[model samples]
Target chain A: MKQRTEERMDQDLAFLLRYENIAWYEDGVVKILDRRIYPIRVEHVICKTYAEVAEAIRQMVTQSEGPYIAAAMGMVLAVQEVKDRTKETILAQSDEAAYALSHARPTTSRQMQAVVNDARQVIRDALAEGCFGQALVEAVHAYALHYLNEKYQRYTRIGQRMEELLPQRATILTQCFPGTIVGTMLRACRQKGKEVILYCAETRPYFQGARLTASVACDMGADVTVISDNMPAYVLMNKDVDVFLSASDVITRDGHVINKIGTFQIALAARYSNVPYYVTGTPDPQHRDTSQIVIEERDPRLVTESMGQKITMEGVKGYYPAFDITPPEFVSGVVTEKGVLSPYELDRYFDE
Target chain B: MKQRTEERMDQDLAFLLRYENIAWYEDGVVKILDRRIYPIRVEHVICKTYAEVAEAIRQMVTQSEGPYIAAAMGMVLAVQEVKDRTKETILAQSDEAAYALSHARPTTSRQMQAVVNDARQVIRDALAEGCFGQALVEAVHAYALHYLNEKYQRYTRIGQRMEELLPQRATILTQCFPGTIVGTMLRACRQKGKEVILYCAETRPYFQGARLTASVACDMGADVTVISDNMPAYVLMNKDVDVFLSASDVITRDGHVINKIGTFQIALAARYSNVPYYVTGTPDPQHRDTSQIVIEERDPRLVTESMGQKITMEGVKGYYPAFDITPPEFVSGVVTEKGVLSPYELDRYFDE
Candidate 1:
């Protein structure tokens, strides 16, 4: 690769192409991408107070790493609110701020909780040093910058591994958007002068593929094509698909992958069609099996409507489970920051 | 049965419910239900001439039996248009009228072409017998009524056979709205004091399941739930699914079933789960295999948008194959007017 990972991160990262100003500090406002209406319209949720940041998380203005960034930004906004107050009040309010921000999306990602806890610890250290003036705000901002930077480096590792594994001019079928995980991978392929064609299934209810994946891939110089969720099997059955790669929300020790609702079905079809299907991301180390993982059943209205528009008959009931489990038997590999790990070698792959 | 097939056909055969007035004769106009904007909006395409009827067919304003009925009504309307003209002109225009109607949806169903051909023959005999006035119009009307009656009877036989096979209170997962084939079957099941719960996937681009099937099922006294196209595999994997019955657009001699794009995937999941998957309706006697059957590649805009709203990123292409082929191994039964035939018993089913 022409640009090394350290060189890329030091100057201008590839994330600037689309998400440059999506999450940033402006005056006293911590702005985040309002992902609810993404791809259709580019808008941001401006958080003046920590509560607004929490509400944005609860309302799902952004998801995955977006939540972690938003939560860290919330802490930055938290210290700004109590600058005029006493030192005791500032210390008391900061803990409350952490609780409010982290609890907004409690089950989001372990990284999000770690970022929140780290930010709180940074605040505690600043207060302990008896420098509650400018040192405190600078410390929180430094931690936020480091948190996102570390996350990007992890993404770079995953992308490099994906670039090494994915074939040139590959037809990759993917489900929901996995933040910058797929975008970085496509960019990495672009750096090697490889043309990566992505077939993105428009994940229903949330439409993560349509609103996020396709948009991100297109902006990153990849040829992105959107297909309805039902069209994946047909494409796999007809086209000369090189691989089926998706980002997993959770990967158990037994290699059971769980992500968006349609991932399992795509994996099933890929298994039957003899297509190589891989889940590329970091797996939750604590999760041992599918039964322990809690699958969220979303409100039925999300499925019956789109972009806040009702598309079904008045009396029709909708069944909407946000995610489904794809047992290890259907999965071929798990491409992670460490390396490309097979389903059977998941335990050993993480152990090292 | 509480309602005899002939008795119901003479009056209201329950095609109403949601698809009411889709095809009907009103004064001098042949009004066809504009199925494109169905359930959400009830509108009709008034066919005043043969060309308008052909255009309606091209626009997909009606499908399956709706097109057959619409075509017959268009013929009756065509006869009315030229009844006051000279006999020579009347006979010439009638032949052209039949050509226009039949070619409107050639690959739709063989029954449609046969009905159009039958009406044309009736017109030819009427003109040869030296009848040129009210007798000719009555003859055309008789052919239309007879065409609808026979089609309904075929539907009745298929519905009855389906009723015999489907378990009571069965949880059925269905793909695209299989026109009145599924609605009629559910009605027959309902009539026999059986309760069937349906999981209807809202077929993308064209919401046949959400806008047509689930609406009709609910109005016909069956419990129906609408799901996004991606939910079918999850439903089959988790739910106590009794059967997977989809309407076939074209069922080949070797038992290859081609229906809506999502049907093949559902069949795959069903086969893997050991759920009985059936393709209801008459098999096309002409097509010998899947390769012979032409799959329509629909406009990509239909996939990028939903119910007239754009849902994809700009510059993102969408691949929308309107129909997909499911091999014989995925199918367990093909319910027809003859009987509930096995995939391998297709030739024998037609032979009898």
Candidate 2:
């Protein structure tokens, strides 16, 4: 019965919201939908080896939650590489692949690492029960698929919670791509006859908000408009923005939200403007606060140039810090699969 | 003696800061150094007629104070166009040219209009003094040149005031191109042997901060770094930004500042971080406050594409408001030719 409900929800998602479009594994190949040039070009980067998948993540072919999903599938590729070998060899190789995948991007890596580690433990348990060879490969593949399914279901529940929390009619200001949760929330809103207007900040250096978030919102049939990264404060001041909603790459147990580089500024503006800022994601039990968070500084070339074309002068220097930490004070609430909880009340998310 | 001092000051400016390089009138043609593709290519868009000059300003071939200077020279072209006609026809044609140049871009148009109108009055005065034809053309040209000299001298004084206001060694955060004032300030800082670090927000859509501001600062031999527009708030939080300084397109008598779209957000962040935010410009005696300011919505194509390459997907809508208003409460002070005055004390700027 639960499977039937999830299948029905799957049909309601936009093209990009579908798990297969974000990433998929088929016949010894892990295919990741290249989000860097997505919507403009629907192409995928094919990876036959785990290292290739890790490189794709480093190159940002897939971003946000796509990395986490792709990393899990990468572990499957690791097992498939040595499927004919001993169970001990497969286990050792898969652990190495998991380490490589976890370190792909610093800010979002911890969760991906945890997912891969859990899969490794599952393999260890299955091996003790006599699972080996092709059966071992099948076991890892099934584990990865199951993990992907659980992620989708969790996001769907969070989206439903978001739908309930959002007003019947709302104008939301969001920064960067928030993964499939936005599309799922839009779908949920449609079912309940709620109206949502989205203003996406065109995340600079990489136009994720423009190409990914806005495209997904458009696919979900929401009234969406893309604004440059700097326009959010102006929009909040002039436009009727009901809420400032974004996805948190990491939500610390003590309630800080680490997200894309521009999120902190928007949160400041929202707080000053009397608008509540809510971040969507499950809390990280490992991190007690923001001290453990590493703000990744990507290649400066990404800022100085766009699509291999120089936007500024040749000699000029550019700084590109990929993520920023938003303190708990600025974040009004965290929308998790459990429900909408005050930033201070995030401990409830981990109670189970 | 005054002319010699002005000439010596002229030598200290960056290549882009020189008046002739900004916009020059020679042999009946007004040539404007195109800032849109400047630093990358030192090219000028030649304008043979007043209409062509006005069109260039509208097209943003020249921006900020470039249009004001170009508009003044544009009036010279207007007078040159009617050099063979009667004095009455010359005066009438110049008036029409003044009106067209004044309305080139909304926020900056009022000043451009005022400069052209002042040139028109000079033409009328010259005609009354029995000047005609070629003599009339020379009179308008002389007036425009004198106006240009006065502007440079005023900005130099303002730059000195800024140098006095800034700390001995400081890191300043600025947004967009603030015309020649930034170059003048850098020169003054060098003279005083004060160390300075500049973080420029690469104002999106046009990239004026990256292409124009950073280039000028580099020429002036200052330590400069270009950051994406979204990164300013993050920098303010993490980096030691001693001051937030920017150029205001319009400063009303009530002390509100209207500048490039991203300025307001930076001001908010600076204020939240407990840093003073200062804007440089003379106050408009004609207007009372932000109510009279016109924030321009530029072409969406400029936002969706960078250097003719599509940054976002097709069929996506982009919002591009060229400027935003910063309330008096957020502005630390207004740096004018007279001195650095509190936003509330802007009335002193018009005491003359």
Candidate 3:
């Protein structure tokens, strides 16, 4: 009771040591729980095909890039079951997976591209080896698992790097779902016995703060304060949140990091508040070109709909830019699976 | 409803002629039945002082340019009851009313400013007469009532111009409250034996469209259909909304219109959809330059707070930008009490 900071540090360290490997199989069946109804309702869906996957993605069930990438891998694997695991099947699956993933979350391009790249590699290896049946299936399975694990480790490394960027008891404001990286990083901080506090923005239209990230932080027991997106100026003025970490769907070669729709405003607020702001993600080759990225237009109802009884309609139309691009200048750093790099260092990974 | 087009024409004409003078006064203490708990708990508050008025205005109990202007007038009148109606009182009342009014809704500036203008005018008239006591009281009352009446007329004229522009049954998409103008216009059209249909946009965060404007339209018995703000593009692309009419907060001398945060995007959408769009409001005189129009910000929690069982803190923050400016280029015309002025004509009114 006397040592609140030490208590929090211990709790976070415990979460870091814990292994949460359920490997919930995607199976082309959209099995991710609908995040829109999280905490209130945990509903899992099975998306059988790429089309269904697209619908789920658009609907925001499996919204995070990690799960989205994982789902694409599952769908690619499902394609093998339907047809012979030929080179054509593998290549076609990669292409289809990429498209499906891109459409799932239009703002971020890396997840889809990353998963498809792994799938294509499996195809290339299989074609060169002249393998079929069990051998081909085994190779695909290994590749899928490898990509997912690689993503996790990249997040872990980024998390470690994030810890180094800030001090032991740094107050942090996080926007959007940073996913495995966030958990791993918080776990890392807890392990290091750091007294870090996360002031999370409850990303509006979708309260990812209260619904997803907050719940996760609560589970891991972090000193987390959930605030609305608009209150960043207040937080910066009142609370001394030392650092800001956000997750991105795409980090363009030009270093235009497209994350959640409200991230740019938060970054602007942070920069104004003199808080360091950073975006964390594994940048893919496809994400190197910002022009190639197509910003997804969300359903206007997402902006118009509210939680109410009798299902009242809000008569005013709303514009939901699913993600906003933060120019490299606003971003303090870009954390990837490889390492945490400054905005200027974006080119090194882009060329990778 | 035989001869559907004729019936619609009859309804539209009635909106212009018969419905302009429906007056609604607060029954002492009024509760803005929470939009989230509709058809369930009807929450009402007895608005006693300027603070109550401010709270109501900030919380959106008295929303829309008409009711907002009316509410501001009421707030000034209520504040005057306690203090001497001097220049300080007038400025303080206007300042507080404008502050609260600005926070009540975002993207509309005319209502608050209009009320402030009315308040300022009363103060000036009060000073000139060298009258204190009952005459001063009467002057305040007269000015407040006059502003409300003036707003009603301006809206009615706008509605009339809208009918002339569209002719047939018009489907109108409204953002927030346009006050009695919209309601009166619908009534006017019906009175003229014209038919018109209204489509309401569920203005998000506050649901001004679904809760306020829809109720007003429905009560007036206008043929109204409600749609989500998100679905406007689809609705405009598919359905036939002849013209789009949104209430603006600030209309600059250069004729830039500011409205709810999302109105700009909708204007862009309307332009793309090839539907004529109009921004309605009276020209503010105090601020000769649009830049001089003070933009008000509100609590941010409102955006995150869902309409349901109360959770989290007693009040999450709510970000309410009382009004946004819309540039003249996207606006087809400006609707005011004087007349429906072409966008180019806005300068004539501001020239004074």
Q: Write down the TM-score of every candidate.
A: 0.92, 0.97, 0.59
List the candidate 3 regions with Cα displacement exceeding 4 Å: A1-23, A26-30, A47-55, A72-111, A123-139, A307-318, A337-339, A350-352, B1-23, B26-60, B63-147, B150-304, B309-352
Cα lDDT, model 1, residue A140: 83
Candidate 1 residue runs with Cα over 4 Å from true position = A1-22, A83-99, A103-111, A131-134, B1-6, B10-20, B84-95, B109-111
Q: Tens digits of per-residue lDDT for model 1 on B1-352? A: 1223334442323344232365666577778877778767878888787779878987788875677788887788788888978977887887788788877654554546776788888888888897777778878877776667676677778888888987777888888877667766876886888889989998887787887888777777677888898888889988899999898878888888878888988888898788999888766777777666667776799888887888877788988888888888898999898988877768876674
Give the top-scoring candidate (TM-score): 2
Native contact recovery (fnat) for each candidate is: 0.79, 0.64, 0.05
**Whose DockQ is greatest here?**
1
The docking quality of candidate 2, as DockQ, is: 0.70
- What is the per-candidate TM-score for chain B? 0.91, 0.97, 0.73
lDDT per residue, candidate 1, A60-108, as tens digits?
7887567777788888888888876787888888888888887774344
- Comparison by lDDT, 1 against 3, better one: 1
Error of 1 at B192 (Å): 2.2
Question: Tens-digit lDDT track for model 3 on B1-352?
Answer: 1123221222332221221212122433323344333323344444556566556555555444434544544544554554465656655665665566545543444445555556656656675677565556456555555655444455566666655665656677666555556766676676676777777665555556666666667666666665544345445555677778887656666677766655655565577568888777755554455666665565545554556432223222234444445567778888775667766666676554
Tens digit of per-residue lDDT, candidate 3, span A1-352: 1122222212242221222221234343435566666656645666565566566666676566435544544544545554465667666765676567555565554555556666666666776788766566556656655555555556677888887777878888878767666677777887799877777776656677656676666667677666644345456645788888888877777678877766776676677568888788755556666777776777655554544233333333344557666778888888775667777667787464
Worst 10 residues of 1 chain A by lDDT: A1-10
Show the colliding residue pairs in model 2.
none
